[model samples]
Target: MSVFRYTLLASVVLPAALSTVPALAQQAPFPADAGESDGADTIIVTGRVQRLYRAEQTTVGKAAEDPMNIPQSVQVINSELFTDQGARDATDIYRNISGVSFFSYAGVTFRGFRQDQSFYDGQRGNPFIGFSVPQLFNIERVEVLKGPAGLFFGPGSPGGIINYVSKTPSDTSSLRMVATGGNYDRVGISAEATGPVDADGIITYRVGGFYEAMDPYRRNTTNKAKIADGAIAIRTNEGGKLTLQATIYDNYLRANRLRGVLVDDAGNFLTDIRWNANEPTDFLHLKSQAYQARYETSVGDRVTFDAGVRYFDAREAQKYHEPRGLDPANPDLVRREFRDQIRPVHGLSFMTNATARVDLLGMEHKFQAGADWYDEKNVLDSRILRTGVTSLSLSNPVYGGAAEGDAARAALLPFTTTDTRTKRQGVYLQDQISLTRSLLLVGGVRYDHFEDKVTTSTGGAVSNRSSYRDGDVTLRTGLIFKPLPDISTYVSWSQSFEPQAAASQDANAGGPFAPVTGNQVEGGVKTQLFEGRLQANLAAYRIVRRNILQVDPSLPPVNGVDQLAPIGEVTSKGFEVDLAADITPDWVLLVNYGYNDTRITGTVAGQAITNAVGDRFANAPRHKVGFWTRYQFPVLDAAFAFGGEHVSSRISLSGQSVQPYTIFDASITKGLGFAELLLRVDNIFDKVYAASGFSAQSGHFPGEPRTFLAELRVRF
Candidate 1:
């Protein structure tokens, strides 16, 4: 079906279903006069508890299930935890998660693998496209599901998936306003309000927006963003609910897409940490619009159904001076090249699922079945201009001397213009069976079909056209044993697959490359201690990935073009511990630690320059530790929070070594009845470290320096 028809069907079916609510109410699936709360209840609670940082249930698996019983490594970071830390973007909350670290903008290294795709409300799509970071103003919580999730989320990186849960309209009427100011001339204001629109309380609405601008710590750089979000919910008398949501985002960055500070071969800094190579006119801009519709209902006392549709459109344009390397003849100067890129993307997705509870042969079972479809088109128009005379000095830098204006653009060389389309569809089934009171078995399987088509042109003439189509089946199974009501142990196995991009294929190969596949085995234990006020999870896992595409060194080049082959394999083994506890009524703490070891176990015999046996994966740290604790003083209505993170040294993709670093942060909060004030400081020690790096020549990204922020929030 066409995207328009699918959207039209959803728009028509929702109101039609609501019209039948009166007739369905006659059946009375739920007791009308019981005076007991049903599943759907909107109640806002004030104050804090031990569970404030811990989420008991999650929808990441396409159903509402307890994380302790899922037999996998799952973690959640709620708004309360990040809000207290003065978080401005998604990366600020990564320290609370285990086995996760920064890779680049809006990207992370997950369990020794790199992934950028994120799910919104359990649907597959990303609104924050290339180089754009996700803002946290409209998010309710962030959930991370570790290991392969192909059985539920479809083809993706084998590492795992990140899900963003949005704040929806509530029946409870409330208004919240916040004003914030920070170092580097940063300032922002936002307001959010939700309430019922009708006297009967059947219709509800939520609206929020924020605008912020700042000068970053880096020299000659600036950042600005504007966002608006709105949502509406309608409830039927029979307990069915329909919701519609819309969001718009505009972001601008000037001289902010920095490659990093230059470094020497021995990993020593060659320049100041805040040094930048981009010109004042260099900028990156992105604009996006997204819309979604969701409907949920219960078929009977033992069954529930959910369906959702989402459409997104985004455009990103960037112009920057990319640092190449040190000049061959003059080591004191760095060579540079100019790049211009324009990318536009459109995406549509649909998802539906149903869960049923049944009993067979004296054993209880929970079964779920779902199907999903996603379509996206991405277009890229890029150009580059290179000149030997464009260089920057190491000791003294000068700007406005490089190429600019229409004349420079007209002299630029066309790199490539390509239009790519991807379509994916999947169906999955899962069952959770209880054989006895202490033992449970869970199993699931999924079938997915993926298609990719790319068209490339140069000077308005078609240069190359490539198409790929393939299908695969992924499986998952787990067994859980409960020794006590508060303790559980489980083991699981899962598989995943991801198709290679068209651009990665060699034009001389004349055949589509095989998709990469991965599988993992894991075991874990979960416990609740201290009268259920503390939750702890420990897990160990090993993953193997095969069929990696690489250049074929054995075969001679076909007309000076390299040949491609799939003869690479990698293995990653790791363990993690996550803990959340409330030592006392006024004290809450969160701690996590991770140990990962990733290496290339197999590769082509002749390929020694890039992939080699026993080589460590890039950006995969072997050890990581994080901790945060907050203490509240009831007498003064105030709180104090302290947290920090430490990451072990890592290797860059180019075999360059990066040093380890530790950072500390603290915050203070004062409650004033209807208002609250917060003061936070990051990098308290002003430590200098490299967050990540591609190579010593291109530069290494530097960690933020000491910074301070103050915020005032009023609620009514």
Candidate 2:
């Protein structure tokens, strides 16, 4: 069988083994008699945990107990919610969280943080994006922690951090399978299972995998993907455990698009788009593999040690087509281009967490402490292409590519292509100190050091360019106060720093510049309501980034001479709100909103003058909003939901601006014995706007329009 078919068949068969667990696994137990708020009531997760109606004892035990104790603004997106929404990609799942937004660019932003600092499962995933690769199917939950995690993880932003929780061993045993298809002829299938392997019930394991593919919701675009993932865990009565997890994913996309520039009647920069939907075509291909092995053991009643090693490799290649005009007369022309990028990232992290209930001189307190280490390597090979010969320039607007495609496409010299490599490593530690029953203090710190190397290739020969080295210390501190059993409020301050790669843009560095450094300071409050059935959190932060990276306009393009690098600084500030609740049994609500005010705060010499449509960072918007909810039908045994995302207009990396647009989406599901069925709709309005462009204006690829998908999921 073809890989796609084989994937679907595996998904279908896995669930057959789990159905024996009984009908209870087929339908969630919380929907029945959900209204008795005070009776064996369900707790509301407030975007913190999966929107499940489970008590503290039912959820991950150690996890559920600390939400009210931490001072930082954090959130947990549960696994059940993943099933409830049938989320297909990381963007589909995380874009709904507050303080986070996936803008018009293919870039992601959290609060005011740039795309430079993203990680997966607390380990580095996409070194290029601010967030790591999308969470996979076996994810148990998603954790979003705000403020500098410098103390426990590495040098992370005070804005927040994201960790994809993998599904591990569980006492509950069951099997699951899923099949789906939708607009763009999109198709996906997958399955999973958990149970004891021995009659003694001393050992258990969970395993699953998935396959998916889809076409562009747009008329001339197509998006297809294939995925396979699984996990196995062995458990014993001593609380000792060892597990293995793996995934293989491949994605392909093609588009006949607009190149990266847009001009008005007089040919002045108006937007970041190149308005040519009909062209020679552009495409991107990506292949990724991630595997991890984890081991956990209990040392005593108060101490537990967890250690894991994860390895991930991703290779991506692209041919970007740039179409630079909007006047029907002058056809779009291809411009700036990127060739190859490969990231081989791996990390070995060992954490010793000791939690103990201690009588400290007459007062009872809970104590937790740990240490961490991380290493990352990044490699990028990029090329810039610009035709030496000028097109009609609209002087004679009535010229076609047929008239120009020959000479214009011919004069297009590969100009300059450069290869870059980055290496970073760090170590950290954290501690939670209790002062009183109602007042507890939290603090942690981390130190990091990084090394970067830049190499350029011309005619196939590689040459060394320059290198960079830098280090910094990050910190986090907070306070929590619980005046009542059902309520807890806290305030926190956090910080994070990016490498100095952009620093090369400093006037002192001359031509090629170094990486920039970014940092943030934030304070926020979190509260739980109605005995923790409902939750809400709000935070405000200021981010001061130095030597903001931007192309050096002064550095003219030369075949083997110089490269453009970030040459300025910009400071940004923002506020965020996150909420989740179970207003009543059978009804669940989730929402996240972010507001940002980012602008060029400082500029180097000649920067302000030459940059007419330049300087403002791309992929960032001033406002973002999203909401989703599911309401169950006790009698019909089903539920339906609708949710969508809205983003304000954004600026081009080159400083041009794109108009603002909003998208709406929704879905529905049904329950059956040992199975559940679902139907999902995306972009119901079929808006023909840009959902994502290439790094703030390379091409105008239409966002997916209205589409539909149906899924059959079974539980054993």
Candidate 3:
């Protein structure tokens, strides 16, 4: 039998066999009624003592609903999971999520789509950039909602969205600190504190931050970053609350490489090398800051309103040498190019929401209405100073050869500049209706209007200006049935829309292209078995995306660009199973498996864009699996965890194949009187592989080698 079959069987049979075991105090019992508010009922699962995988409530749907009550796939990763896995960013956590892949700076891949946008406290005001990895020191938890969420998050990729909930102020005094040291000359320190500010206990505050520096695994590569976050919460006399939060982050990187070694036609790695592709003098610097203010109040016992405003500003500057291609004269020598760029961006958002719960016609209904507006402006100045002639040896490379100082910087002058602005406004309404004691229905609709404009300046002259506008409507509906209090079966249908800026300049007689539309149909089953200690979920879904821009093969190139037409469609279907269990007081288990088949089903007649209709989506693996287990030793007061990740062969956009590889990892943590020590090792097998990529030159990013870290955490 295949590994997938065995995993599926284990996922189906483990809960049944474990149900006979006695319950433990690791996880709290589920609430008896679903109508209760999630104020004090919300459970925060951490790794300090007993850590459970299950989460009670999530805001993925723009509402605090029970995970079992929702008719969709929702995965929650608590702080405990973060600490055990040593997850500092999305890349660290992607291994545990089935069907999620990382492609370097291309962002994250989910459900056969590449997703780069994220939601912070359910707000969109930041970019998912390579230098701007999310800082987890101030994060409470991360909720991942799979499938199209346009009705709640507005226009976005059909792959779904990642929501990060920031840590908030508490009414109790607490302080914690962590110091870490690891291979590659890594060292870091982080601290957090929260407490009441006044005698009445009506006001509270939280302050936390982290500073980390590392000499990366690749030769001549280094990274350093610092983040600070603060929040204040005020309780009004009339049963209302206000929160103000701010954050600042600065990151610097030297000799950061974007791609790796080249591969031959047979997908054989030509270079047995691991070093920075960039020159030693290259550097990337980024700085960003954000502020948010929100107020929430209750009008009556059943009605509540919330309003918020957020602003973010960021700047990035980078000077690097990029790999171009192999030299025609000698394939052993790789050509290189030099680039210098600077970008500054600003974003603002405003939102308000009202929710009410009422009993009508012998049933209960929860209604919500909200409106949001966002605008972002960006400026880019870039130049390519040199190309082709510069080269590097494939087998061995020596640094410090490239010219540095003002001479090199002066060569990148007279940069081309671009200014772009985008704005979006959306309004939505949703209702969760209880049709019967065991049946629930959810439905929502949203309308979005968006506009984008771009202007370019070349050679100190205003060159061109282009603008586009469009409007779209999205819908979401689901049905959930429960035969047992701990079991739920659900089916859902949803739609998403995203405006296309690429087709705005197409020289075609078909008129302006329409926005891309995506629809999905999904069915799933969720169960809380083993006395609420084990949570299992199985989901199957099919999604179709239409109105994709395809090149017109029938028409010759016009002005060096092929004519475009919006007559393409893509489809993705998959099955996913996830299991999380705290089998006993000392044993914990987490498992996930996914099988995805994504293909381009239709396109303009007799036209192909390198990727054909029958080919699977680039960088999307057909099979993925992850398994992890941890056991705590009573006498030693320590926990040990081991896990492995697997991925099947993947094809790139140019049809270059990426061989499948599996990696193993392990970690151990011991608790003392006031401090906890942890040791973690990744890629324990020391297997050399490529994680994911697109091409031989600009892709084929190499995976990290065997790495280890030791950390000490203290709490007061």
Candidate 3, residues 477-595, lDDT tens digits: the string is 99999998899999999999888873355444343677889999999999988666788999999999998877777777766766777778889999999998876666788999988
| Model 3 weakest lDDT span, ten residues long | 36-45
- Per residue, candidate 2 scores C-alpha lDDT tens digits across 416-473 of 4454555556655555666776777777666676666665665457654666666777
Model 3: lDDT equals 0.78
Backbone clash total, candidate 1: 0
lDDT of each: 0.81, 0.56, 0.78
**Candidate 2, superposed: residue stretches over 4 Å from native:** 1-65, 104-106, 125-135, 156-158, 218-221, 254-283, 319-377, 381-421, 502-521, 547-570, 604-617, 692-701
Clashes of 2: 28
My TM-score estimates for the predictions, one after another, are 0.91, 0.77, 0.91
TM-score preference between candidates 2 and 3, better one: 3
The lDDT leader among the candidates is: 1
* Residues 58-83 of candidate 1: C-alpha lDDT, one tens digit per residue: 99898888887788899988888777
